[model samples]
Target: MPRTALAPDLSPGEATAPRVQGWCPGALRPMMSGDGLVMRLRPRLARFTREQILGICDAAMRHAAGLIDLTSRANLQVRGVAQADWPALIDIFGGLGLLDEDTGLESRRNLLVAPDWVAGDDTERIATELLARLDELPDLPAKVGFAIDAGAAPRLLDDSADFRIERGAHGGLILRADGRVAGVPLAAGAEVDALIALVRWFADGGGKVSGRMARHPAPLPAWAMGDVAPGPSAGALRSGVHALGVVCALPFGQVRAEDLAQAVRSSGALALRATPWRRVLLEGAAPDAAPRLAPGWPDMDVADLAGWRVEACAGAPFCSQASVETRPLAYRLLELAQQGRLGAQRGAAPAGADTRTVHVSGCAKGCAHPAAAAVCLTGRAGAFDLAFDARPGEPPQTADLGMDAVLARLGVN
Candidate 1:
């Protein structure tokens, strides 16, 4: 389901406007928090040097919200920060030499850094260059995405990006366009710029997209190819990721400054990696990690781990524009999925304890996912639209099921 802007644009804004409207409801530019820019971080890169980890924690506490939100994309977002600290943090990022300044190219560059003892130098520089080029992109074709997967840990594999590059390319770096991950040789040092140009060209031609596609999204680029885009991910979510040692949903996808400090202070764990799955991947832990889980700490298993699986946009709390809580709805749908009625009735689930992927959105933004899911619950004023993929080429079979009714229908009291 597609998410609609809070109050229809009455007259929409520019290329980057949707991000503001989509991620944030009312801000024109990124609002500066007290110390850092309130943004999300990707966590696939988990091994932060002890010094780097400590410095990040200190900066996050002093400048930003002191809270970190790990995302499924392996990105990290420090919230509650004031605007003043942004430049300094940006500088700090520069000091760490991890800051890539590509105006308005933030979301466009989901560069995957390898999660090994030593960061891949080429991947790092390439990611920086990609960020610069992505920034130069006036407005990427909505459908285009660019990723430099240095085959990072868990390897940011098969994401919904318009283009992906990795070390194993037939060429120095292969470019996967139009959905396939086949390496298309770039004119050495030309991959990043070529992609920026490609997306710009597509945007000029009218391609509106947020992530990658499983196949060509129609019209031009007949030769492009990419793997099947993954569903809303829960793997990198801090509040939602699988416990490095335990299972728990991170509260609000954030950790208290004190908690973070404690995690950092603990022996052995020397680094932090933020993942799009919304979880913090603590690196350099003691030989035994079982002793590290704080008592009474939230259990990762309690959550509808798949909450991230349903790609719903920020619906209520953060997005005042949203009419409801999309994550919660997605959670409910996942639980209802346990009922296994849809697949069971349709012969889709396994014998028992099956997991059926579902996407629930507060509105239509559908930030969590752009591709279709087995089920989608879109919230509307006074009710919800319960729908499912009846089949491709066929209209979606939908009903006027509101939240309560939908819940009841799902067999959840």
Candidate 2:
């Protein structure tokens, strides 16, 4: 569901904008945060060549805070970018073929592809066709997007998208809506046409007012509803060797520029593919490359980890809207894992029971993890409000406590 901005707190006759933002950041149009700027890059097919990867790392080190964030949409964000250096950084990106010069086309080409797609597969072909026909799309809302999950089974079921191209129970193609269970069946190669038609239907039906396809209340057209169900989920992809490459986890979906460059060099991978799950697939990388990345970086092959399930935003001084620091608390939670408080908690009992998924949002905006988590700590007036199995903006079970008080509530000394 699309989240509305929290109501602003204002005095009589005084005015202020709501703390939440509606548009997403892009490389051409970045967002201003407590940090300098957040410039997001949506890589083509969520894959980056070696040259592009090295160039991005170099540019990040030169023009930003040297930190790159992997987002839930399988995009990359360069943080702490100075306003003065924006144009220079963009120039560098253009040289690397990372920039989409047309702003309208870039915004309209919001696509999420299955990372495991092989060349000439349905995933790549449909995504390529849609990219070429982006100009044909109507002026839809910015937050709306499409997912091409035409692999053996849909792997992006949990990721956000307005429309989806997935496999049906009989291994045929289907164009599914975000909220609907069934979808329109498609001929083997007619996915792009069907997707375009569905998009047009959404736009003609006042979908812009809803801001996202899932939230659009209009019923689907008669032709758009095929009674067949989608194929079973392919499950979450973890860090390990696969037929195409080696997957590695990025703790908190963040990586230092230096470490990323080092991994690229050490692994000698031909390319890197980002995923919504905070894991990167190093294409053509040797299986042993995972261990060579770093000690702190776990590949999930031999390491029992919980950091992959924790989400934290840039807190306090880094974000103007945040009242308290968040990452430190997230790290503290990981440290507690050493004490056997939550050892090897991944894939165990559900979230609230064993505290598997944790989100430490700097403020109620919950920029890091918008959905509900097992444990949530939301910042408010320099204190923290704790919630159990809730989103950051939801009412908390405990409120108005300092950091130490929060620690005590979690049973920590």
Candidate 3:
């Protein structure tokens, strides 16, 4: 394969300026990170067949660095591909039915489907309808997305989305925007039409300037707002078995490609489904199959895996903006949990509380976990700034401490 040409003025891996990109990467248009080109793959209805997953794993090992990241939008991103290998990789992806017709449609089809939806369910139906109408939508910002969370209750409330189709107060459907508390009542089969109208309204009414529906200053039209409120959340999915399948956690939202392929094959799962909570649902897999799927995969009934509670980004050499290597520190935190010293660690939650209390960012951007964590360690100039009960970039409780000093401050031995 031939390499894509870089700018004439800049050599490979050299840039005149440092900046974060606003657009998300896709199969056709990948983002260049410090490690390599990052290509994102979005499966239809957030699912992949067993064969498709196997093909993905094989391709990653041959073309990239064999590393795969499960994104918060319930998508998969293959990291560390060289410029010369992208064309072949894209061909593989297209054969697997993963690519859109073109980059324009690819960028516009940012839909997040409820992972637990069964075939022919309302969630699947709505998502399928919306996907077919992608060409009708006006150009949207790269980050703009839609959520089809019409499960028994909303499951994607915490995930990012601009427009949402969720269950109404009375079990009917409703269309709501990200920032608002209310939603417009939606009739069955009219979900897609309602969504298209809402999107056009946003685009024509100065929403392009704001870039996000939540940040758009214009008030929604009166007809777009109704008294209906979305149903209560079903809550985050954990590493366990459910009626539909087995849910397995991906430590820090990452997995080696071979391990994933092995897990899928071993479980005899008909397909794979992704959730924003760093978990994967093996559709049609037996409830007891989790323990036997793959090594390092968390099975809730077997043993507690502290990696599920921690969020860390690709730090140091993998990311140009990072000054510290984050995963190593994150692993040390896991070691503390194994040593039974986790409770004494600062920001440790009480028993029965949400255990995902730690966030280790490569930089203040907080790309790994956007929500506030009980403890956030932001990298700065080869050291770390510790913040308790806050997000990254907030004033830290303590600043400029080496790793050892940080552990000492946490009262670690």
Candidate 4:
């Protein structure tokens, strides 16, 4: 494939200017990041064919920074694009059927489907139905989203969402509001209607404090049903008739465009699915065989619990808001934790303490993994402030620890 020509006289200030906080980026209007412009593409049905993947890779290398990021919402972003090249890049994405004809429609289509959904399954059916009715939904908060998790067991509860349509215990469809335990029982034919009604209720009666369904203060509709039991923890890899592929992470959720493009081409899989867990699902390939396609690809096995335990933001030079680099530190911490180096020194955590997960944020904003972690590191003027199982902005246990000191505290020599 031929490379696209770069637009002339693009400057750093023009390309990397800050964007509105909480505003999501899309192909039509990309957000400016520390690197450059970031154009996010949400693949319909959370899927893309091999051809689409290749085209995206080519476009990224040709017009952007040759880097692509898999977002927590099961979307892909081509980062570090020049301001001048955005038009050509958007044109390329449209050619790949990646852009919605109307930008409004694209923004409203924040739906996540079960990555392992098979043809004719409840997940696929309901997602398709809901997608078609997106025009009917009222204007919602930019970050508000929905999850369609109709697998035998739910796989997206940990993912951020304002509403969810998941499998009920009795094997029926249930539409549940986020941050609540119960959901209204929905029959096969009425799922879409119930979802729209709930969305309407939120728009009409929800409080001003937060647009999220969890923060809404109004009473739920009378049609609401039974309490929802939480699903089993998401395993790194799943093997079933519906889900037969491997799930792998990008070292702190960053990937070179070329590396991913080469892997997909070599895998021979027809499609790829992004997961909210900072992983990619290679459909139609065995777990063991898929990793061979890309050298240095980290395919997390079921037993690799450490790999599933760390989350970090794109810090420092890549994010204008950041004061330090996050991913490199996260990678180091993960290595030490996996080797039992940290565990050996700190001893077993208190019963019920969350010792498995660690979150590294670039600044106090905590853009990545906003929730508390077993060990949290927030950056401050190139050093770090440490906290234990606490949210960002909470006072740190120890302040202003340099990189070496932070590593020492983690018991990493």
* Highest-lDDT candidate: 3
In the order shown, the candidates' Cα RMSDs to the true structure are 9.9, 7.0, 5.9, 6.1
For every model shown, what is its TM-score relative to the native structure?
0.51, 0.80, 0.79, 0.77
Residue 124 lDDT (model 4): 89
Tell me the whole-model lDDT of each prediction, alpha carbons only: 0.47, 0.78, 0.79, 0.72
Clashing residue pairs in candidate 3, if any? Answer: none
Q: How do the residues 1-413 of candidate 2 rate in per-residue lDDT, one tens digit apiece?
A: 11111221112211122245556777777776545677788889879999998899899989887878888899989987877888787777878888775556666768899999999998999898888888889999978999999999999988899999998887898999989988878998788899999999999999889889888999899989887788999966777888888888776777778788888888888898989887889898877876334345333321235332567887776567789987668766655654446423222334444355678888887767667777788999998999877778789889987878877887764
Which stretches of candidate 2 lie above 4 Å from their native place?
Answer: 1-18, 291-309, 314-329, 335-409
Please say which candidate is ahead in lDDT: 1 or 4: 4
Worst 10 residues of 4 by lDDT: 1-10
- Judge candidate 2 at residue 192 and give its lDDT: 89
Candidate 1 runs further than 4 Å off: 1-38, 41-66, 80-122, 131-138, 141-144, 152-154, 167-173, 181-190, 193-197, 203-254, 289-413
C-alpha lDDT of residue 246 in model 1:
22
Which candidate would rank higher by lDDT, 2 or 3?
A: 3
Model 3 misses residue 222 by how many Å? Answer: 2.4
- Compared with the true structure, model 3 gives a TM-score of 0.79
lDDT string for model 4 (1-413, tens) is: 21233442223223333323555777765666656677889988889887898899899889877768888788999987878888798778878888775656777889988787888898888899998899999888777889998888888877888889987776677889887886777877888898998888788775334767888877787776457554553433342223546565665666777888776766555687877766677776554455432244334322345433777776776666688888678767766666656543333445665666677888876755666667888888888998887655568888998878988876676
10 residues in a row with least lDDT, candidate 2: 1-10
What does the lDDT read for residue 324 in candidate 2?
Answer: 94
